[model samples]
Target chain A: MDDNLMNKLAILAEGAKYDVSCSSSGVERLNNGKGIGNARGWGICHTWSADGRCVSLLKLLMTNSCVYDCSYCVNRLSNDVPRASMSPEEIAMLTMEFYRRNYIEGLFLSSAIEKTPDDTMEKMYRTLDLLRNVHQYNGYIHIKAIPGASSDLIRNCGYLADRMSVNIELPSRESLKLLAPQKSFEKIMPPIENIRNNILLYKDERKSFKKTPKFVPGGQSTQVIIGATPDTDRSILSVSEKLYSDYGLKRVYYSAYMPVNEGPNLPSLFSAPPLLREHRLYQADWLLRFYDFSVKELFAGNSSSIDSNLDPKLNWALNNLHLFPVEINKAPLEMLIRVPGIGHISASRIIRERRVNFLDFERLKKTGCVFLKAKYFVTCKGKYDGESLDSEFIRRKLLNKMDYQQISFLG
Target chain B: MMDYLYDGTFEGLLTCLYYNFAKIKATGIYRTDTYQTSLVNPHVAITTKEQLADKMYEKIRKHLGTYTLTDLYYCFLSEKDGFENILLSFIDLCFRNGPVYAGYHTHKEVIPFDDIVGKVKREVQRYVGYVRFKAVGDVLYSEINPEFFILPMLASHFADRYFNEKIIIHDAGRSLALISKDGKHFIMPYTETDLPGSEKEDHITNLWKEYFQHIAIEGRINLKLQRNFVPLKYRKDLVEFSKPK
Candidate 1:
């Protein structure tokens, strides 16, 4: 490894330390008949990262010498910190070496603005280029696309990478202006639009050739930092819901801000992006994606923004009481997902597995499910174990529990 | 009856097993290194003879499920000493239960056996991410003593992945490997080598210098909890926790 390569890797990797996109992973790392291993899980499987993300991947930065002055970024040019840049050859070689010994099954490559926008993008493309062409590495690779890169570079990146992301640092353009003054909302939209169109083009071609080229086969995703600026979870989820609606993005990572590079404009670390707020946004976002709960259906309800005390599902279930008491044996898959404690996969599994037998909590638990909160709203063979249907009482109980967990942090 | 032993090779091992069932009392056995045997038993080193192994396969197949036998093959490749124990356990399980394992039939998907394999795979994973190698001269080394014969499983994880950088992952338990890059790998009947454990310092950065101090919020110093994740055994090998010379 060259000195420049090591330097670049250190800067960018240190810069990427703040991202929390490790949990929302479905990408399994498999070998191509030559590499070391794959990411197959077992019963009671546990994973851990530097930040307790617990999933696997060598999450690092491609470079940290950024030309853009995004106030939220540690690698912004004005900041006096050591910077490094990795050549595609160096990056690919490291990934292969680590992969052979099974340190990780994939690479999460992100970079800062170095020199011109095109130069930054060219380096990112070349890294993926070397990983694929020279090394024959057919593995999980998630690359973060710099917003201001040329259209050609963006398209080529989509072709080469398994997943691509462009961080929408703040929720609204108004907040973006206040926090990240150098970044414009307009500069962000073009890439999102281009990736969306390219994904669609690849899908269309796949129907004809069956061997049509893969373009972001793992799909596009982006992150929006929470608590960095004055954006509500309500507003953030709205933007996230729209990103999903418009671009067909696979995931929108919500990073809870940890008051790292604090200044007068930034929020205090004590009152930073409340970790629960990030959790609530993920719940509400899940509602939009899998539960088919619309933004209006979520916001127009009396209890706007998810309940701080109860989970988002419980909050919604309490708000809309009449929708509950649905039979688990009879309810549609959509209604099942809306039930508290019923995840998308479990709900679908319930629908499939129930065809042979009338499903009970016994079978549900066997398939990795908890019906603690769900029992109140759902009945299996007319067996309802929870209390009366006063939404207020349930709401109060849920809130009290949340308050207990939040304040009991000493444990 | 004569027992045979040979340098580690699947064919050689299979050949011994084959003729042991065919030529004499079908009782000839193979062992890796020199050792004593019963007065009635004679021993010799064996090599790959296709016809002998093929005939043995025919007889073993008459009474053994092909899938169960293949699993035995994969498990044997692990070169773990306790492979015989597992083999006995497997043969016992098969005779007692009639090859109820899902992998027995090519058609009926046996998920539970695969799930056990999956459990073993996780052990391989924990070994990979968690193994800490001590650097010595040009090479890095770490010794793992896993419960099962995990050498074959661990071979690809360390060697092929670290192709450019040379590293040795020794199965301290079985002394076996599944390495791809040309390097020293073996399994043996116990010998002694005083491994240099914590000799490398001043070169690698002191581990836990930043993460332990900076990870949690300022006031919450949960040493007990942190220690629980990183056990005491590993600390003895870590340079950060070493007593000042």
Candidate 2:
């Protein structure tokens, strides 16, 4: 553990930590022979940060020394912080050595503002270029899109990296203005828009040509720092919905803001970034993406914000009682999945199995639907036995049940 | 008292049932890893020929269905006392009751086998969540001596994300597991049969090096939580966090 290697590791890992795009998504791969490692289909990374994220990759800093002082950053030139940087060959060698030893799934190379965006991003790109072309490293590589760098470098990076992320760190331009005066929304949006158009263009070209262009096969994903600005859940979600729909982003990661720096107007690190609220938004986000639940139905009776006590879907079901008591035997897959205790797998199984024989509540337990939670929401053969789905009553009952379980477990 | 011994195949296990029902003074049944008694001696060992094993495997399949065959495999893997008697009882149910209980929930004979399989599944789930990896050059390395026979099918889980990397998995207990590279993989036998080092070695045994490098959250040091999940017994060949050996 030389002081130099340790410093390079620390500075780079810390710089990389602020980026929230390390997810290894899609179906997992088998560890075939001749490769250095394998992916767990269920995606098991070794450890997680306090905010519940996986750390499988050798997530580290290429360099932490920054010339530009972004308001949201602690490693800015004006701020007093230890600095370190890894050379291009050093970064690529470390990544290969780590990959060979099964220390990481791949490399997630990022850098703070080193000398210039061109020089720093060029250093970053060169390391990836070495790993890809020289070493023939084909493992997962996630690189950060250097802000204000020319589109040519960003475009070239998109070809080699498995995933590329340009964080919309602040929610709106006003927040960006107040916090990060040096950065602009205009500087950010174009790369995303260009990447989207270019990704489509590459796909079209590949469809007709023998040589397929390697254009960000995993597609582009971005991160949003939650509670950093005065943005509502609605505001953040509206932006996320737009990112998914408009720019064609793969994932819109929600990172709970950690105020590592101090200022008068800047947020303090005391109030734990609403983890539960973040969780609610993730569920509601899933509902919109997968479950066909509109954002409006989620906010029908309540105010714009998400409920902290109950899960968003269950919260919606409580208000709309008439929709429930849908028969598990005959209900559509859409409605069946909405019922609590029934996961997507169980719903599909029900749809398939019910074709052969009528499914009753007793048999539904073995059918994989959790009857304990689903009992209140669903019925079989017209058997409905649950209290009315009034919001207050359901809320009290659910919370009381949770409290009872917790107290008894503690005792 | 007589010890009815059989060959080292699953059918040889079922053959024990065939012989056991002929008499009642059955006691002290154990796998032939060690221990010899004057009563049965050792020569009477019955071997589960590939044909016989397949035949009995098919019998369970015909009467008890596919999942019951799964139960039988796990029941044999359990290494519990009187598992033979429990298995014999289950076979008796296949004969006594009809084939309705093959996939049926409310049946008499399937409960014990079901219980054993459930326990195995729990261990599987825990291993799935808790399994960690270490890189050795280009090959990722993992070693586990699980309480059950689970390593053969675990590769399907880990290979996707590591598509370009190669990995090796060793079953410290069974002495062999698997080594996969590129996209090709094969299971090879291993044993603590050879000497590495005892628990007295200093520094990481390669795996410890991997685990130390794996942690990104240095601030969240919860050894109690890690120990609770990993347990002390399974930590020996882990190489990374294990005490010098």
Which prediction has the highest DockQ against the true structure? 2
Error of 1 at A363 (Å): 7.0
Q: Write the per-residue lDDT of candidate 2 for residues A1-411, one digit (tens) a residue.
A: 344665556556666666666765542434334433444434445434332355556676778888767666867777887787788898887777656544456777777776788887788889888987787676677788878888899889888887788878877889888877878889888788878888888889988896876787667888887777788777777788888888888788887666777766578756555555666788888877777777678776557777766777787788787887788778988888888667787787677556645777766777677676677788788786556646676677777877665443222
Candidate 2 chain B weakest ten by summed lDDT: B199-208
Candidate 2 local Cα displacement, residue A324, angstroms: 1.6
Which regions of candidate 1 are displaced past 4 Å? A1-10, A22-47, A84-93, A135-138, A262-264, A300-304, A329-332, A344-368, A400-403, A408-411, B1-245
Q: Which stretches of candidate 2 lie over 4 Å from their true place?
A: A27-44, A47-52, A352-373, A404-411, B1-143, B154-169, B177-189, B192-240, B243-245
RMSD of 1: 8.3
Candidate 2 lDDT over B74-160, as tens digits, reads 777665655665666666666566555444332345556666767776666555544555544444566777887666556555454
How far in Å is the alpha carbon of B151 misplaced in model 1?
Answer: 6.7
Q: Give the Å shift of residue A234 in candidate 1.
A: 2.5
Candidate with best lDDT:
2
